[model samples]
Target chain A: MKLIKIFSFLLVLILFSNCHREDFLQHNRESVKSITGTWKIINAVRNGTDLTDRFDFSRFKITFSDSSYIVDNSVPFIVTQNGTYHLDDPQYPFKIYFETPDNFTKELDFKYPTTNGVRNIVLTFSPGCSSNSYTYTFQKIN
Target chain B: MRKSLNYIKRKISWQLTIVCAITALVIAACSITIDSIDQSDSINGGETMQSTLHVTISTNAEEDNSRLMVAVLVPKVWNARNNASISFTSSITDGTQKMTAVPVGTAAPQGNGLDWPTLINNKIGHGGNLLPGWEWAAFYSDNAYNVGGNINLSVTVNIKIKTSQDNISFKLGYVVAESVDGLSNSQYYNSAFPGCFRVFGTGDLIDFCNPQLSTVDPLNSLDNDIVTLNFDGGIIDNALANQSNIFLCAKGITTDGDTLNLCRQDSTTQLISQGIKKWSIDIWPRGFFNLPADKQLASIQYYFTDATGNVKVGSTGDGSTPFTYTFKCQ
Candidate 1:
């Protein structure tokens, strides 16, 4: 009887662990779906200074379709850049890794906030130079 | 009865051993499957994957001339492995015929001995280590006068990277120069006389056969010594321009407060190569040797000027100002 009880306990533990792994994977997949879309830069701040008038922020558009992304900038000149991006986690504090066409790999954190029934994406870039930081607030257009 | 009981115990032990073996095998198979699944997930993980090879071309304006220079730059992580090498083959096409490009060496302060013309024939990093962010350059000379007049020059380069694990090839094209004027106007001191001073033994005539100075300073020169000042006109097309208009002048101040004119030559007959002219002057340092002892030679200046007095070439100060070289008299 004692041997039968031990076998039963081990079987239950294995099933519970398998279910937990599946739950974690499903959570990650669902998180990735929420962050995929076309986002337009509505506001930009650099080094505690606003640079909307100095730069044409409205001309910048980042489109995300499935796993790949492309950035189109037409302010001073029309330039299109394509790259691949990945999410480190599907939950809060989302870290997005980008690999540029020029062979540069970088990571940026993204925040998803909903204000007044509108979803917004915010990205900050601190380029390891001085105390300068660039914050880009994007609105989901599509 | 005792023998049967012993046989039954042995059978039970065998069954237990077989069960344990099967369980261990199942556990090992499960671990391998889990690891494979993790690897697959990581690859498909929402991230951008990149190709192994990347190449780019950047241009910089030459300070002395109007010609533009193109440099090939490679990323730091592209070739991070042992026994790795890269081969670059570049050519210039002018819509008619293709010609091989002459690999230009880096400018002064970085030592002229580090030129890449000799290394361009083989793999760049063979038998040596190639660090990240290294650059190699080539320049377009207007040698072909037939394909002249505001023509577009295309520099097509083929790069091959070989490693122990894999080999990759990249073909890159760049428009190095457009509307290039066929007339070349530039000059530099001959590489043989690096710093504009050549020393020789006492009573030794200027050896044209071996122009390269054996030493920067001749410790054996007596009171009266003759030294040759050799200058090569670099890329300057003196054939098209007036030959008599090009001349070089050297001036020195004696230790006795008197100005001494060493040597001046206006002859353009010495042809180093096609379109390249040579000017040489032999100077006897009477004032330099007249110094008591161990006094340094000062205020020795030389310059090349055109008929219009516009400094065409010199060793110092934007090639317009006079170039000076000083050394202690032995």
Candidate 2:
């Protein structure tokens, strides 16, 4: 009787562990990796000067989902109006683009770095002159 | 035995630390100094300006064969990399020596992977110029010369730049270093500032040397940019000086000849006081003017106002001509 009871417990544990692994694998295979989230600016720089504390960038936020993007409180950004977006290489992106409704696209130098256990998106572009470059760093508003 | 000598200095990077052997011209480590700098205080736009810098270099070794490097910091509008010419003459070499532009990405030796311009600008400051845009154009001697191991030499570098047709006041700076040291430390290079220079031309004066009553943080930007407008109530006696609250009244003229009025005395257009009678406000042109996505700006003409928006102050402090910011790129 004791041997039968031990054998039944092991069988149930094996079934539960196997079912959990299968569910995890199935979820991973079905979902595509994306940068779909509401992101807010945490830092800003003009040329080489840090303007994070000097200027007010608290109201700016960007939301990216699949192929669509929306901007709130637009600053000097890649595009004033956004309709769609894309990465130069989604897996290892070096550039990102904001595509307006009319298909007018603006490309910006893109950088993704993990810091302090948090991932960030850094975009650099010159809104006015190429001599004056601006960098904006964004973090997911989770 | 070693001897350290003092020479005329126009900047900190130009300070030469000369250590010499007692009996002969043997340099344990050769140092550099700028004895004198000759440049004009004023140059007219659309013309070529010529300047000469006299430098002294102590040779590290007779076998130290390296190209001499020189760089100049100038406004981007001049496009010094394309329009400027740099050459030098030395006691150890023949009449005129040729120098060519150091290619864009050539890393400076001993610079820890920094390029010549970046290394120089980081080590040497902006020569007291206040404006944001400055370009450092570096050059290298066409040929390498091992003049001698035991030698002290004097060099004169001639610089000629074709001034752009914009009225500008800039504090000119220069740096001299060899290919080997590459501005690794202060001992490796010498830098100098000739002083404030001005080019008399058209448009409003883009003065980098002096303060202004009303100035923009970035003198160049488009309607899509976040621009900071600054007003110095202390610099001039304006009508709104007594009021604690200052506002911005601006008219943004679009590229399509449409004028957008953004003048209001509410919270949005209020300038933050930075004390000492200084006031500034950062505004996004697109959002400030409430423009449609397709519209673009040509220029913005603005003025400072009081609480009721009655008292106004412009470039002339009395609203004669509005302070204007024109969109431009180079």
Candidate 3:
């Protein structure tokens, strides 16, 4: 009975150690990649206007790398803009930020709360005009 | 086979342990987190962010074109909302010399002629186009006539921005008869009087009026002169017209005040077929309001009337003949 008890204790200790080792290995492999690619400006709206102008339907396109982006105002690559971007992810789901030369910084947050399981992202910004309200939505591609 | 399997297991275990250690290190290195995020949802990133935008706008009064140009400097970051919506307030300088010159040597639409009524109609405060807040008031200083026969006249110009409560007052200095010799030095040529001048009947300075001093040879001989004016300082190339007709007239104000008796009195004695003489003054501003910013160049030309009343003969204004310099802004 003494020998059996000793063997049982050793088995428990080995299992516990192995489990912790596996957990540590798993954590090491987790890494988030920086997003870089083409982004489409789905829609833009100027608040407080009588909705008389066709500016609401206007769409823009942008391309971003790790460092810089461009705003194009011509055809084929209509309204290509270049700017800088940053990221914030204190919470589980990460947030994106963009700053243009016009001294405007857009802090983008997800409209629908995301969790660790979320593979796609949608961020929104506010204060579209001089008013207290704005909403800019962004989606992750690739 | 059993020995190989055991060896592989050992290697896998060691790899796992290394990976776990690296992971822990990474998390520890990146553990820092920001706190006290802005709870209040302020628009435009708050007042501190909005105040970062800086812009300076300058408006130049081009009374000749009846337009005021507003120049804006947009910092590289912020884009302009509506560049076309920029506005301007008008101002005028009338140096009390109602008698400005008319160039008879050039063709109509490009030159000034004996049409005093129309010529006087197109100035800054005239033509019924004076802005509501812009009033034409003339003030003179007795300094022109002191104890001695020394002339030191200075005219006061009041420019008020009707849209804003702010107003600016500047003085346009005049020249004395003795200082007339200063005209020979192009750098120091000014009108006898500077400031807005209303025609005798009208209460506003003519929209297109400029300073004029004339001398005539009434006996049809260049040696016999009627009036001689020497400018102490004048704006080099600023003009009321994109293309201006500059002139130096020897004029006589008739007692009737109905007709302005005038003749082209050139320094030369020979009388050309067409009597009227004209000049075209061209000088572009070196740069915007900041004068010392650029190197400026100017050109002067003299014209004599042809049979068709067109200016044909062109000469440089080295002051060899009676000539006037008219400056225009682009």
Provide candidate 1's TM-score on chain A.
Answer: 0.65
Root-mean-square deviation of Cα positions for candidate 2 versus the true structure, in angstroms: 9.2
Candidate 3 ranges beyond 4 A from true positions? A1-13, A18-30, A41-58, A72-81, A89-121, A126-128, A140-142, B1-330
What is candidate 3's lDDT per residue for A1-142, written digit by digit as tens? 9999999999999888778677878878746544566554443332221211222212334566875666443211211235787667423436566777766666656443334554333433322112212233333343
Worst lDDT run of 10 residues, candidate 3 chain A, spans: A48-57
The DockQ assigned to candidate 3 is 0.00
User: What order do candidates take by TM-score, descending?
Assistant: 2, 1, 3
What candidate 3 keeps of the native contacts, as a fraction, is: 0.00
If both were scored by TM-score, which would come out higher, candidate 2 or candidate 3? 2
lDDT value, residue A68 of candidate 1: 78
Q: What are the runs in model 2 whose C-alpha is more than 4 Å off?
A: A1-32, A53-59, B1-47, B58-63, B94-96, B100-124, B149-152, B180-190, B237-243
**TM values, all candidates:** 0.24, 0.76, 0.22
Q: How are the candidates ranked when ordered by DockQ, highest leading? A: 2, 1, 3
Global lDDT scores for all candidate models: 0.40, 0.82, 0.28
Chain A in model 3: its TM-score? Answer: 0.47
Kindly list the per-residue Cα lDDT of model 1 for residues B282-310, writing each as its tens digit.
33343323443344344456665554444
Among residues 3 or more apart in sequence or in different chains, the pairs in candidate 1 whose N, CA or C atoms overlap within 3 Å are A86-B46, A86-B47
For lDDT, candidate 1 versus 3, the one ahead is 1
Question: In DockQ terms, which candidate is top?
Answer: 2
